[model samples]
Target: MKRIMIVDDSSTIRKLINYILRKKDYLITEAEDGLDALEKLIETKVDLVIADLNMPNMDGIELVKSLRNNFYHIDTPIIMLTTTRDENLKKSALEAGVNLFLNKPIQPNLLLYKVESLLEGEKNE
Candidate 1:
C-alpha cells in the first residue's frame, strides 16, 4: 500500500483528506504543519505529500524546498492543496519543487485521479 502524508494545520482538513484517501486503501499520515511534516518525515517515509499553502511555522512552499534539498525525498511527489487564489503563490510553489497545485474545495474524484496519475508517473520513471 502507498503511504501518503497530509499536511495542514486544520484538523478538519486533515481528517477530510484522510477519509477520502482511505477509500483507496492508502496508509495515511497527518501533520499539523510543515515543521511537523518534516519531523514526521524523518521517521516515516511517504510516497506522496499533500499540503496546504498557508500553514503555521512553515508553509507548503518551504516544505517543498526542504524536501527538494533532501536527497532521500527529492523525488517524492508533492501536491500543494491550498485555498489561495494568488497566482504568485502558485508560481512560487511550482518553482519551489511542488509537482502539482490544487485549489481547495477540490472534488474527491479529481484528487484521486491526480494522486493516482502522479504515482503512476513515478512508477513509469
Candidate 2:
C-alpha cells in the first residue's frame, strides 16, 4: 500500500481528497498545513505528497524546499495543488522541486491518473 500525505488548510479539501484516495486503497495521512505536514513526515514514510500552494505557517513552496533539502525526501515525488493560475507561482513551484502542479477544482480521474503515473514511475525506478 502506497502512503500519501495531503497538506492543506481547508478541512473540506482534505476530507474530499482523503475520500478519493481511500477508495483506491491508498493509505491517507492528513495535515492542516505545511508545518503539520513536516511534523508528520518526520514520523511517517510517504511515497508521495499532495499539497495546496497557499497554506499558513510555511506554505507548500517552503515545504517543497524543506523536503528537497532533507536527505530522506530528496527523491520523493511532490504534486502541488492550487487555485491560483499565476505563472510565476507555478514557476516558483517548479524551481522549488515540485514534480507536478495541478490546478484547483481538480477532476478526480485526472488526479488519480497523475497519482498513479507518478507512483508507477517511482516503482519502476
lDDT for each candidate structure: 0.92, 0.92
**Candidate 1: tens digits of C-alpha lDDT, residues 36-73:** 99999999989999999999899889999999999988
- Please provide TM-scores, in order, for all candidate models, with all chains considered together: 0.97, 0.97
Which whole-number lDDT from 0 to 100 does residue 7 have in model 1? 98
Q: For model 2, where is the 10-residue window of minimal lDDT?
A: 82-91
Error of 1 at 92 (Å): 0.9
How many pairs of residues in model 1 come into backbone collision?
0
Q: List the residue pairs that clash in candidate 2.
A: none
TM-score of 1: 0.97
Deviating ranges (above 4 Å) for candidate 1:
none
Off by over 4 Å in 2: none
